[model samples]
Target: MDNQHVDAWKDMIYPALISKKEELEMLGYEQATPEDVWKCLSVKVWKGEPEKRLHEMVQDIFHLKSSVYLSYLTIQSYENDDLAASVEALLGNTENKES
Candidate 1:
């Protein structure tokens, strides 16, 4: 995956990203943002890309399905909850030791 390619295409793809974000929101993902949409595609849709071209990226964004994005959000939410629980458990252990 080439970060350079993604960076180079960022400006050109902004509108498409925004459109995807809006689509997600209309489907009830109000927290959706352009970054989230891009990340989901980069991870799920692109899936270890050699680096997609601008047009391909824009097309992917435009065609992204709500179900796929919803699944991504659900998994992400669970992962974030797990991380928070782990942190709380670690903090609880530290407090117990201090006491």
Candidate 2:
């Protein structure tokens, strides 16, 4: 793949992996290592425990509760295209708060 394609893949891959991790967690399976998650994604060699690293990386990239909620909202947004309003309703004026 070209550099642009590689970059796009890299960008898209992480969110999909994150979504998978969330789905697995919801199903009650704690990922053993980030590498395990990556191996499962078949995207790359995971460098560390998937659970811990994924959790840490997610938190680093997104605010604590917001990241989780954002991930959830993103899914819903795609599902119905009304997630923005849904998020506004769920969060109320808090949605306008500074991040």
Which candidate leads in TM-score? 1
Number of backbone-clashing residue pairs for each candidate, in the order shown:
0, 5
Regions more than 4 Å wrong, model 1: 1-4
lDDT of 2: 0.45
Tens-digit lDDT track of model 1 for 1-99? 334455567787999999888888888889999989888987778776546676777778888999889889899999999999999999999999999
Candidates in order have lDDT scores of 0.83, 0.45
Model 1: how far is 49 from its true place, Å? 4.0
Window of ten residues with lowest summed lDDT in model 1: 1-10
| C-alpha lDDT of candidate 1 relative to the true structure | 0.83
TM-scores, all candidates, are 0.88, 0.29
Model 2 TM: 0.29
Weakest ten-residue segment in model 2 by summed lDDT: 1-10
